[model samples]
Target: MIKEFREALKRFLVEICEFVQERDISFPQRPSGKYQVEVRDGIPSIQPIGIKPKPDLRALDTLMVGLRAWEKETFGNIMEIITRSERLSQAFLTSATGDLISGNRTMVFPKIRPIIEAYFAETNSFDFQQETFNRICDKVEEELRRLPYCSKILQCPVVGIHVSPNCSDCCLQLESDLQVRSLSLEEIEEFLEYPPFLPSFFTTVVEMKKDMEIFKQQLCFPEKDKKRIECVVIALRLLFGDRIFVPFQIERGQGILGKVLLGEQQSYSLEQRVVPPPRLLHIVDQEKYTELKELYHCISETLLERDRAKIAFSDNRSKQRVELALRKWSEGLDQVSAEWKLIAHWIALEGLFSPSSRQELSFRLALRGAIFMEEKEVYQKLKMSYEMRSRIVHGDYSPDDPQLTEIALTTEEILRRILRKILQQPRNYMPDQLEEKLLETLTK
Candidate 1:
């Protein structure tokens, strides 16, 4: 690659020399003689008596000055070419060499060094600038092999390119390079001022964090109540399947910012951990599970607690619906009196617990088919949920304890998971009844 650049440089300089010599050859000086002056109308002109000076050669001094200027210009052009070629060659060379070389030694074209040496020997007065250019190109190419575009540029066909290389850097060659084009300095400033131009990975992390915030806010109180937090995690196991602390750890505090998961603590970026699944909350593959787990932890930690008692709950219709639904299962339990938050949490638990009896199984299947799916992640969540159900059903748990001062706090944990799943997915959890209502509204 260096050889090609050096060859190009040599060709350009030689061409410039040819142009200079052709325009600056000495001509026979015109015989020193006086010229006859003639008057025509109001103008007077002088005519040469002997052979006139050759137009091409008469301006030798000016041509010599221009030739020198062009020599410098040609050298500058070489520097520019060499600099650009070196930049691209680095990209190409890195890609071509892979990780085989220790460093950038991948770009050193040892094959072309001899050719350069021969060129200098033949042209006794070689351009010192060219030699320096060659050394830098060779050294950089050999040294910085790991640079993103180094391997890419080295492989690009410079000669065949139709346009000027100065125009723009192609993304293919940039290798994750991001450039913001703006017409004016103000526009550039605006782009730079925009805080969102973090790395693509960072942008994704921010989004995941936002979702987790909303989930936490939703989980803070009963489902009927809404919290101010922005994001919520829908499914915990959907996020952290099997292991608890492998991908991320939960961070909790007083404020919204405090609840945020410190994704930087992980070895991989959030992007690596939480790649959005093809379907929300559908934990079919590993990526889906990873995304869900990260979300769950974040939501759980950030979830706020409601300050006031259950008075500011959702409307009576929702309350009545809850009462009717749970009346058959738990006779004494007032699903209606239960705070909307608690009711939503309980509904989520019922959905996740996978009721054992045939009648209960039918309800579980109905809920699963309705809002959730029967995936591995969901099954694992069901297992976790049943542990809570065991404490609530088997043990002497209280329903009227307002503060949930009962046998255990499994309800809260199960509620958190269910809420996270809800936050992770709202549309899926949208009741079939609600879908019908929406369709009815649309038709109306």
Candidate 2:
């Protein structure tokens, strides 16, 4: 009976993190009252309920009285309890051996008497234990009742880590929808001082509180990273809770097919590159039109080679190359300054010759670009592109920089050349090795 009491007392105290030696205290098998932390209909409640009381034992009745008094004073400090209850439990433990064993030295182990005489110096001291406890419970219930029911979950599959090109190498673009509960970009930076699972050394240049189509960024993950994908999904669910609805479009031709929810919780269709709907060619100038016609076929044949790869790894490898090629191809269409386009072009070209310095990377890509195009002018444009790139980086961009258009076209021409080479070559798409072989062949 004593051992059972000790275990129950130990569980109760440790659950509240107020640990004490259970062996030093004794509990009644039939507790008179209970203070319970109960959950009803998804809401938490700390309720006090009366329990069956044991009869015919005066010492157990004393223990019950002490427990009820302790519950009444629980409104005070979490650590502080009814002082008498502690003394009662201790006294009950000692009563088992009686007062005769105080001076006897046992053969197996020495039984030492407790040094402290009493847990509370004055039991006669009076305090308002019950009244204060009732007030606290009332106030707690009132506040909890006023809170909004959390029936819906609010979660944001927050895309926090954005790695763009070197122009913004150390810079990060914080993206999320602006909402009342959205964690600020600055708050995220402080949180990353001890990141849960991502790198944290990047500098903040511009913070976007909530502007980007945030859900689109999640499409970057593929099936190979399903575990990592789940981790991110779980993290978002935790940070924002269940009301998270990520609505994004899966491109199909020029029109919307319908809407679908995107998350780990539901089944999602794989994103496929769509074929553009048929349209008539309208070229004002017939000369450039024919040139573009041939260029389309050349790129198409290259794409065919890219599509033939059956392996998952190679498919991803080629997908990245094609995406880079398309991005570099489209920069000429962006409504930005020539210097901005130059910067964008240089970044796209980094895949071919990835070195630290922009100048070296530009030169090497230009060398390969020139070799592929069989045009000496591209090499000169490559050199000039680097000089202009530097001016833009240092905030010394000149609007009237000579030959800006020529340089932009030459940059586009080089990206085209790189893509064509990848598709035409029998040897698989290997940019890193291609850079080495090209450098060795050109220099020697």
Candidate achieving the largest lDDT: 2
User: TM-score for each prediction?
Assistant: 0.20, 0.30
Q: Pick the candidate with the highest TM-score.
A: 2
Cα lDDT for residue 26, candidate 1: 21
Give the per-residue lDDT digits (tens) of candidate 2, residues 267-366. 3233132212112211113343233233333343333333333222244555565545544544332424667667776776665445444556666766
- The reply for model 2, stretches above 4 Å from the true place, is 1-319, 355-359, 372-376, 426-430, 433-444
Instruction: Provide C-alpha RMSD values for all models, in order.
Output: 24.0, 22.9
Alpha carbon lDDT at 349, candidate 2: 65
lDDT scores for all predictions?
Answer: 0.31, 0.36
**Colliding residue pairs in candidate 2:** 153-242, 153-243, 154-240, 154-241, 154-242, 154-243, 155-244
